[model samples]
Target: MIDNEPHKTKAYIAGVNLNDPNFDYYMTELANLTEANNMEVVGQSRQNTEQIVAGTYFGLGKINEIKSMAHGLKAKVLVLNDELSPVQIRNLEKLTKLRVIDRTELILEIFANRAKTKQAKLQVQLARLQYELPRLHPSENSLDQQRGNGGSTGGGFANRGAGESKLEMNRRTIDKQISAIKKELKKVANQEDIKSKRRNKKQIPKVALVGYTNAGKSTTMNGLLKEFTDESSDKEVFVKNMLFATLDTSVRRIDLNKNFSFILSDTVGFISKLPHNLVESFKATLQEAKDADLLINVVDASDPNMIQMIRTTQSVLREIGIKNIPMITAYNKADKTDRNYPQIEGNDILYSATDEKSIKLLAKLITKRVFANYKKFNLLLPLSDGKTLAYLHEHAQVMKESYENDGVHAEVRLAPENQERFKKYLV
Candidate 1:
């Protein structure tokens, strides 16, 4: 889909830190996330508290101060860098007199606005409902109690049929909507399952890209694909540098050349202290990560909290039961940083995908790492068999090839599945 840049809105952002070291990075990323969603940061406020205040997010005094500052600046919106409770949200709204949003709510609103596809829409709705389900207002919870008025048997809507109370009716409506979204998501999953099965049948390797929010996962995905595909064609390749840029999993068949096309999947990125409801809702979408044969864990080389981000990503990966998968850490954005080295231990590669040489290095490393798990084979094909020769050149690494009187003698290294295809051509 074509993307027209959005008009930016001026807003104020605040972070309440209980003396945490990562507070600065969190607030910084929060600002960027807001900007990505077309909000301009007019000002920022940070409050240090010995303990988190229960009533207001940043203690009563700091809340008043922020309110005064926002009022003076005429900020259109007030964004909290931390997660705010429902009561706190309501209280803050009353005090600040501006639209107050917590980080989770802000992220959900961004996802809701950015979702374009049917699967993406369903995913966002499921996530939003899940987030809302537990945060229902006290009055809303009372609606769940369907005890009829005046203790009469016909308490609710009083009808000949079994009518529900106002509260029960609301709950039923929400439940029905949730159920419908899940049902639609299941259909999309089934379709994806069929595609997954077909790839397995062909013995294609599945590689998934996972990282923290705004670590450039989607940008890297675009660079990887664009490296191989002719992007100048009428078909425009979608690449957004924004956080959660690619909400829905986009699986593309990448030609590793020499008869091998491995599947590359761009999955949702993980975040520090990600809300549980969002995680639970996105489980199906993240199943693509768990099922991956290899994981390309992307990291922002310029981020100060790179270590924390790494741990957060690992925490989620463990939660998903992906313990023993081989991973290649791709430290991205080397171009913008003073230095691009990460001290993390792993089979890793560091490069800005924007650089042509970096793209080549990444592609080469990908091919090398993926083929390491496969067996090698040698075969002889006739020179007249142009089709098989061309196939070999496209999908396999031809270590040795020679023109012969009878045919062509070729020794190749490839995945085992290609072994059978070359069997008939073997001398």
Candidate 2:
């Protein structure tokens, strides 16, 4: 019988430590990223150095040691913990005889693989092209060949007529593609902007869920939607126990009751040292968070690296220009820990997203924080003022309402803006 198991690329992950305290955690994350990209991490190496070698990332001796050890381990790819310069990548590949993939490229490849929506696809493609443009070299036209059309012919052909090498033509083509993708992206963004403007006009409070990848954000969203919204498969976002499972922003209206409703958005999760290009390209998708009135920073309480993960989320939020937004730290996965479930400490909640009681408590905490400024009002509207009564029902949290000879009498919680609108009806 012939053995026909599928082959997985054997990858050796390595990193140079400049005495950073988080070096080990970074290496662990690199290994996870490699696995997420469908490669098997076969072995690992690390070097402690005062400074990185400008031309080769690792010193010559370290590189030689890595080369020998990787060969012994049957590893065909060298995965680095940090992004490398193009020169460093080429030099390492030459020295080690293994294909070199740096941290940034590895992350971009994952995003490319995970992108499902057109906007996400275009964003990843734009970022990839931007990353590749400067890395393009004359000798690497073989890359184009590998993709297809190996010979110097077709559009990339050196127009023996123009003396442009296929390399230059390839660069030109990428530039054109980048421009075209940007134009299309802008059009899509404009459409999103229109919808966003409409949502803004409603003046509903917006809350965004942001956290580290695989931290159970999508699960939390599903829980909220299930409990607070009409339960439907379409209302649920994708949930999986994997990195980067969600690439697009999902926005839903969360109706807590007849009295309280707010817009909720779940955004792409953050990772440590995410590729700069990826972050830049996904800014549009993160707009929901940037525009939010409050943010629920969900965290994996069971993870040992919880503190670092929290910092990573904060760093990414700042990079995206989100500032001074009120945030509640939601420590999820409390079931995996000995701590109490659905416990609130100040503005933070420790809970499991899957537990119904925990979800309810989380919702209560969110409602309390997001609606803290709302004021209670008692109003009486005349029978002819049915429109005013309807407005109160739609905009304010109507706590109590009854039909009377005067018209309609109600007690409601009114947001600051609506407080002014209903002042004339106050009793």
Candidate 3:
């Protein structure tokens, strides 16, 4: 078979740890991010310091050491854990003789590559422009040679292929682009808002799946789709074993039974140290979760770093201002471990999404939570009120119905407001 894979750029990862305890985990995330961006991490280096150097991130001695180590590894790119100023980036490149990329840029590049929808693409573009807005310098700097590099490493803040032209874009041009993207995104967000309002009008309890990247959110979504809905492949969202696999939020109505149903939405996964601009740009895309009556925070139960991953999800949730929402800690991928499958402990569960039994149990749990507020009612409407009969069948969960000569008898589950509206017809 012909080898069809393209060449992967060799990258050396490094970070300046300013006495933080989670530094090592952050570095591991950096390496994973590098690979996710289609690069190979050849090696890594870190500096534990009390204070960062003003000009460069790492001290001069450590910088020289990293440069030597990276050169020995035959790495073409030097990836850093923190976002650096333009001067520091230029200085690092000149000293290390490799293209420099920061953590923020790496994430943006991944998002830029993964964004497929119009709204998602525009959001990523908006974030990229905002990130570059400040980094762009009016005058020429030391990256003149980067212009000749031909973007072989793919387009990014650091790997900017055909580099100088993008760097040469003045602030005014970038500002205009930012404004245009914002205007377009606003229109799209308004459309999304309209759709959300319609869903709200249905009064279906909305449920959202949220978690760290590559944590099986899409797989769980597929499990629910296949179990509750038709097994048509077109209804399933994309599933992949990589970071940020599902960028666009997917909304589908999950009907557990005639009397119970909720709108389920699978959302974009979160990552550690996600760029602030990216979060702000994605707020509209994440509105489903914000409006959700319940959230399923999926976790990779088999991964060693599950705790940190959960923390990362919580952090991003907090950043997006989502608080007091009911959340279920869904520890997925139990088949990969030695533990028993489909066990619920308080508000959390240990289950595998691919198992039919597990999906049934999860659905049961969701129904219990989402329908907890519903009130059952018995009402008699006049035979002339066919519109009300149709409305009750469509909106309320009708458990019993009958036709009488003088009126229609119905026993249904209704929300609090619905309970009050039809009180006149109470039987």
Ranking the candidates on lDDT from highest down gives 2, 3, 1
lDDT of 3 at 394: 57
Residue 338 local lDDT, model 3: 99
Please report, as a residue range, the 10-residue window in candidate 2 with the lowest summed lDDT.
154-163
Q: Write the per-residue lDDT of candidate 1 for residues 1-427, one digit (tens) a residue.
A: 8778665676889988888988887887788778877788888899887877788877777878888888788787899887878888878888888888889888888888978888888888888887776565424343445543322334344441333344456666678889999999899889888987766655567888888877877777777677776652332235666777677787787775655557788877777666666677677778777888789999888877888888878998887678798899899888878864322334788888677778778877777778775656668787777887787876666767888787788777766767778777665
Task: Give residue 407's lDDT in candidate 2 (0 to 100).
Answer: 78
| Cα-based TM-score, every candidate | 0.77, 0.89, 0.90
Q: Count clashing residue pairs in model 3.
A: 1
Model 1 poorest 10 in a row by lDDT: 148-157
Model 1 segments more than 4 A misplaced:
1-9, 138-165, 229-236, 338-346, 378-427
Best by lDDT: 2
Backbone collisions counted per model: 12, 0, 1
**TM-score of candidate 3 to 2 decimals:** 0.90
Off by over 4 Å in 3: 1-3, 141-169, 382-395, 398-405, 416-421
